[model samples]
Target: MLALRDSTQYAHMTPAHPCDSDDPERRFRPLSPVETCVDTCGLARDSAPYFSQHNKRYGVLTMANGKQATARRLKMADRAQQLQDLHFPGMPEILLWHRNRHDGFITIPRTLPIVMQAVDAQSKGQPAGHTLFCLWARSPDHPVLSIENPSTFAAEAGFIGERAVDTWRRRMKKLRELHCIETKPGASGEFHYVLLHNPNAVMEWMHSVGLVRAELYSRFIERLADVGAFGEIEAVRQLWAQQQAAEAASAAAQTAATVPAAEADATAQANAAPEASAKVQIALPELGANL
Candidate 1:
């Protein structure tokens, strides 16, 4: 027997529950009522067994279908109720922001802090880390962002003074030089369109170029393993190798195709030479007889 207050609050369904009914209105009809009690109630239906109002509370006395999924849902419902109980009076049920709700968020790599450290270690004076963070904040959960206004971005990146924009540009250049980002010329400037690279790949590149310190690289690897992202570096490398192989195969095929055409042309030209000589001999008179 299940105690259900609201259909939306539980997901246990008896084996004979008409959950898959073609008639949407008749969905979730209880199988066989042992005792009919009631007042018709209006409630949002989800995945609950059909129930009736009993003493102003909705209740259903039925056996669950005994599915593992159903059990899991029951446990989840309990956990959700527990969390809801923690909500205090006068406070909204949801205080934290989530991606599911709306915009005003950016998703970045979990290993971003290590990547930033690696970037800063490359140049002591420049604050490329801050610039990178600013770029990420401005992005819409994508790798691309436009930096149209230099002064505005400079301020956002914590740069100040008369040369603040210049300072910001230098850090941008540094990021590009390290392969953390790629940029293109636009109406704004050289870095008007910036395409951020995966920081994990950038870290791997830095390690290859000796830009990342050994200790930091070790930590980065460990953190990646912890977060199940360690394979991304090797995955990127393998993808690059596959691309190179494909390009080489395409170029070789093109060369082979051109060589066959050239050979066929040469054969045709050779065969045509003898026929032309024979025609010339047939057209001319014998030299001695003509004299």
Candidate 2:
């Protein structure tokens, strides 16, 4: 049972005794729930009964029908009462809501949708995006829907049809031209788009194209990092550390070069002061003698 109240006062209100669905209509805002998986997954949801080897936080749950399922968040207060009560015995607030996974193929990455629907989450090889994307890829039976195949990517991602694929592919070409992505030749004469790895560069590019906001861009990058995307995050951090070290070394060298010049200038000033004083004394005595 879910309930709703004023957003400001929602925290103070006591939980109603299992009220009917009192949640109101959603505000006029588009929704995104999925996230790009990280290398490490946190504790599993209270509702889920199983766990995945890779995603230690939660295993893909087995439903009544024995179909392995993943978690999807509800737009409304799926578990508001639990959080509001402050007495609910369960996992942390982050894993409060235990809802069904959204069923569909997604073209966009996780952290955007927060919803995924699939039979098996682990198949083919893992990639940097959603650990779920591993399951979302083209299976033999589901071959028609994979992103690698264009048509599937279009449909699942909200594109129209085969025609949409050509348009999107063309758009990808334009994006490639802009250097947002790189298109490399793959087997079977197909082209694969390698996403740019730099989060700052990606954010700037997305903003320039009106695709993301500061908040969403940050969230997107965070989720991408979670799922081991952009290669290894540790590796990226290492590179950043190395760059900082190089810059520090350069600054130190520059300071060292200036120190010698500064010392020489000081020494020259001290020597010149005695010579000037002696000349002034000698000139004054000669003028006195002549007078």
lDDT of each: 0.69, 0.40
lDDT of 2 by residue, 1-291 (tens): 111223434322222111111233212112221222232343221111111222232211112211211222331254666566675666575664433444444344443232221101111131122322332343233312223565655455345754866644554454344333454555412334344323334433443465554445444434444443423333554576799999999999999999999999999999999999999999999999999
Error of 1 at 256 (Å): 12
Q: How close is candidate 1 to the true structure, as a TM-score?
A: 0.53
The runs of at least 3 residues in candidate 2 whose Cα sits more than 4 Å from the true structure, single-residue gaps closed, are 1-201, 204-215, 222-228, 232-234, 286-291
Q: Estimate each model's TM-score.
A: 0.53, 0.30
Compose the digit string of candidate 1's lDDT tens values, residues 1-291.
243334532333321233233353333344322212232433212112232222122233232333633575568778866776776444563784546686688888878999999999887987598788788889878898888798999999998999999999999999999998999999999999999999999998887677877668756764564454645765876788899999999999999999999999999999999999998887676764677
